[model samples]
Target: MDGVRFGEMQTSELVVSSRANARVKQLRAAFQGHARLSGGMVAIEGDHLLEEAWRSGMVLKTVFVSERRTVPGIVPRGVEVVRLTEEVFGSVVETQSPQGVAALMVPPVRVLADLFEGAGAALILIAAGVQDPGNLGTLVRSAEAFGANGVLTTPGTVSAWNQKALRASVGSLFRVPVVGVTASEVAELEGRGVRLIAAVGAEDSGVVAAREMDFTAVCAVMIGNEGSGLAAEWMEMCDARVTIPCPGPVESLNAAVAGSLLLYEASRQRAVSKVSGS
Candidate 1:
């Protein structure tokens, strides 16, 4: 037996038929973002993503595995398990090589308040209108790697739930609470005592050179669109507008590159501050 013989499994094991099945439709809808899972639930695909979600301690509502693929590793004892035909599974998965495992999980409900729980400085990344999913995903990965508090996207930005973004994020999208709201709402984060630093292209003097910033203070670094850059109105809301001092002739950096640089600088400053005890 290939360890796939359902005869040895519990009678309650679900074998889904018909791509039109209700559960199949729901799974497909989630990929399309048509189904916003209720009560904090989220749809994540692939064995790797499912493993990441499990390791992160998110509650798994159900695990969907393709009949042809090997059974994925150990799962929670009580998690609902559903088996799907290889063809049906392919239809719901976003990638060309479906990992044969996916899960519907409940994301831990987080808020702006949840991010500021620990002591010391708060580092945040604000993305205005990054249309490219890869950029958003790369930025999120950088934010987590560089220790950003959170990532907030403006209304015009791409949906973090989009399959491409989620795929590119490589599971950081789940690690970080990616919030989507308006530019004005970003100000509210400041009212609660975060220092807003906006990156602008015009300023010759970079805003407190990222290395020079006092990461000990709560801070939010705002990065805008690739083409038009930051809007005048949004930039005005920043406590200070900063730019990366580039010695090269390049007029600008990609949105993700700029944001990653800023985040790494913030992380470096915080690490130094901790060591120096200043």
Candidate 2:
């Protein structure tokens, strides 16, 4: 009896079984951008995103998995791992095709000062009143592809942390800084010597065409509401109002489309400047 080993410690202790566990509850909230649950962490789902987080050396807070998955690789040391049943995982996410893995990560905290934190940034996108998450997400991705320093959003804009936005971003949420700030704060960006370009549907002389602008200078391009466009105050603050010269039956470009086109033009200008050393 003294030598009997009935209760040897098992490695399975690392695995969690109950769906009602606090960690699972936290993960559920994190999926919805709850700061308390996420603890300043960015939630990412699917193997591809997890891989992206890993390869980027981002610190992971916890990893959640559905019942059917196998451990894919060596999780970083000190990171917590959670396993759940498929039903449990489904309840935690809004997706139909659950990839069975997710991670809570700490994204780099960026501020307005960080915009010029590095040398020679030419453009940034200010999503002033974009209400749709998908549109906001697309803007972020486009900003990155077009070499913008970051994407900033004013109050009343839909959250970039939104699940739909996260999916639409295709991981650009992690790649680019999407920070939310107040309209008053945005007005100050112009005073800081960051040229503010507001995109408006109608102006007296019409908005300057993207092709003729010099994006090689530090600037913040503002894209506003789908319905109302930029606020009157925001419009008044712009160094220039810019528009994409469109020749179509369409009244105007979608907010994301207009923003992306402008960003690409900015990128083109930057590229040309470097080539010609101007």
Candidate 3:
């Protein structure tokens, strides 16, 4: 295909119409998590997400735009832009309405120490086997909004890079540091002077209300799976367990809602303590 420049913007070089094309296959594989094993690349769709990825300084591998859509100017020079026919783009993406734009990006590399780099006291969120991608994505966004240092996902948790999770995060996934860890690794947070707080659904005799927790200090709040709640062993590792009080008929809050509430409370307390100089 011949390149067509838009004003001064760099142009696309190739138009892919075949589903069997190697680059098209790679995009699909990245979305399906196959590319992740070999190249650690994740496919992000929509123009907004692509812009967010660029603003966050992520390295873009390739950009794919449907034939009907113009290449976004935000795409940097020297990056390869592949224009795919509408049919091929539809086949490659998971969304009901393909956004006409997608890009493969390298997921950020983070270490455990990166979570605690500069903060005097850290507020961390842990996702323990959170199977729902939407919930996990919301938790990641909430973690950043509430000033959490970073998020840690246990081995069984849904990947923060999952396309559903990425889309649900509304680009906050690119802004926050999410690292995977083993259960044992999670237990080690306590060694660094970070208190472990488990978020449970209903009130228990031994558990404290979320408001009562001293969030101003370094703490990591652990949010569990949607269906089963936290594993008993994981809860046992926590310095304390806290629950949100609900007077209504519902048995529990959604995992993301519960986690976000806890994070907001933490943020509120920390802000108050900072203002009071206490």
TM-score winner: 3
Expressed as tens digits, the lDDT of each residue in 142-182 for candidate 3 is: 99899999899998899888899998899998888899999
Expressed as tens digits, the lDDT of each residue in 209-233 for candidate 1 is: 5555565688888888899888876
TM per prediction? 0.87, 0.89, 0.94
RMSD of candidate 3 to true structure, Å: 3.0
Clashes of each: 1, 0, 0
Candidate 3 stretches greater than 4 Å from native = 1-14, 36-38
Which clashing pairs does model 1 show? 207-242
- Model 1 poorest ten-residue lDDT run: 2-11
Rank candidates by TM-score, best first.
Answer: 3, 2, 1
Q: What's the residue-level lDDT of 151 in candidate 3? A: 92
